[model samples]
Target: MIRKLYVIITTSAALGNALSLTNQTKFKRSPVGGIVTVRAGYAQTPFPEWLTEFTGLTEWPGIDPPYIPMDFIDFSKVPDYKSYPQGVCGVNPRESCSFDCDKCVEPDDVYTCSKLSQTFDDGPSPATEKLLESLDHPTTFFNLGINIVNFPDTYKKILDAGHLVGTHTWSHPFMPSLTNEQIVAQLEWSIWAMNATGNHYPKWFRPPYGAIDNRVRAISRMFGLQAVLWDHDTMDWQLIAEDSNLRTEEQVYHDVQLWKRGKRGLILEHDGSEKTVNVGINVSKLIGDDQLTVAQCVGGIDYIHQYAQK
Candidate 1:
């Protein structure tokens, strides 16, 4: 890594700098209307610290990756794969890993507010302004890089609103299905996006689809990102559809009502769409102002390591 840094003085760090981007708009729409982030001033030689592939040309780079392997990844941080004959964990992770990473929810970590905590994922979407306006209490936003680039102004508003921000990967992909380098690319690109736009190196990460394992956890930890899992799932993304899988706003509230008290819930929600945003607003109202952001619930002063600090 040191050698790679020496070899490329103008590393991807330049790519990360807001000053280097000549384009006023972070991205542009292609003829087909697909969002393509302008790669101007991007490093010709990728820093060992950043992505070797998946440079955010498209919205979902990791969704259908060629699974290219790279030499730059720190293999020492990765753990050996193991089978969970209990079931296919990739299909149902709650039963397999069931790893709850929120600190205040656990007893060992220093205690803070025991209030019910909610986390919004797959956002800083188009509805971010409404969602930010709707919440009296701060919450954690596990945002995707695609959304962050697509909605840069709204994405910046998250920190301005006093909400904790974390990476939800560049493109929301099933982690276990990806190669180790692919996993690294996904994580590093997300980190790059956060740092470039927000000047934040997020300490928290939520694996999209809960598709994490020992290997995934190890890789993320090496990059200083802790993987967080939720206890209660609102399944609010279903609101975008009119199918049998759809969970109505009323049903979501009813489920929340059934949740037991005193045990702080790391509830899953979204700000990714109009429907989910409305449901999140209503849920915030129903749950009242007692709720806390994920970091506050975990006794954390802040969840990001600022670039200025580094």
Candidate 2:
């Protein structure tokens, strides 16, 4: 059985403010286009659990709550594989490999340039606006589909601020374990969710945990997304989520040191943690002028796909 609760926000300004606030309150549009706010405190459920429920996968064993893989993904809904052309091995068509191809030297497989691309993954969070406000330059946000649906207002704010948005998959799954059809579903659902919120589809995709293979890249190409990997990883997610021994302030210095060494490429960080937010604010002192979005770093290759009419 499902229980439904709604809190109506009568004004657009109020709705915007409510959405922009923290992720404490969940908002969704009603069938008649009314604003419905659902207080997230009711069940004390973590965001991942809520995501599992939102994606309709509550009953799967061991795969409950935080586990991303589930039986809910319907392969039949994905596009027919024959509809797209086959991928080449190590050339124009990157072939699927069993191992992590992020270190591949192929030009097409790599996403580096002369300038440093500031990129954040797993966001559209309550902390996103604060991070954006702290930076004088634009950054790239690789968002999850579940986060987009849960926080549409935050997602809209990210786009409105002129930051480049990309797909980080729907549930932040490890791509290697998923079938090709499942990979397609992850990318498709993310793109669809982003389209539903902001009427824009992303042109770049960063695999969660930097976990990608030839198959993942091929599926990404099928959806018209270029795979972007990071050169410098701050390990902010480990520090925050896993309580690693690395201190946040130390990581900030480490990031600055990398910048000081003239290591210019895609720098990876997460917007989901407060530690990362601090790093983003302080790193500006070092690479503020050098910071560029993934698109800008790559010579402004049209990364925006106009899928929605807006």
Q: What is the per-residue lDDT of model 1 for residues 138-224, given as tens digits with 9 covering 90 to 100? A: 788888775566567777789888888888887776676666777887887777677767777888888775556666776777777
lDDT of 2 by residue, 1-310 (tens): 2221111212222323222322211111101111112325222112235435556554222211232433544444443322221121232232333223224433454455477556888776667768877776777888877677667777777887878888888777666566666676778677766766767778888877566655566667767788877656554544453324424566456555655566567666778656667776776666766677887776756356665453
lDDT of each: 0.60, 0.58
What TM-score does model 1 achieve against the real structure? 0.69
Which 10-residue span in candidate 2 carries the lowest summed lDDT?
Answer: 26-35
In order of appearance, the predictions have TM-scores of: 0.69, 0.67
Of the candidates shown, which would achieve the greatest TM-score relative to the real structure?
1
Error of 2 at 76 (Å): 15
Which whole-number lDDT from 0 to 100 does residue 302 have in model 1?
Answer: 61
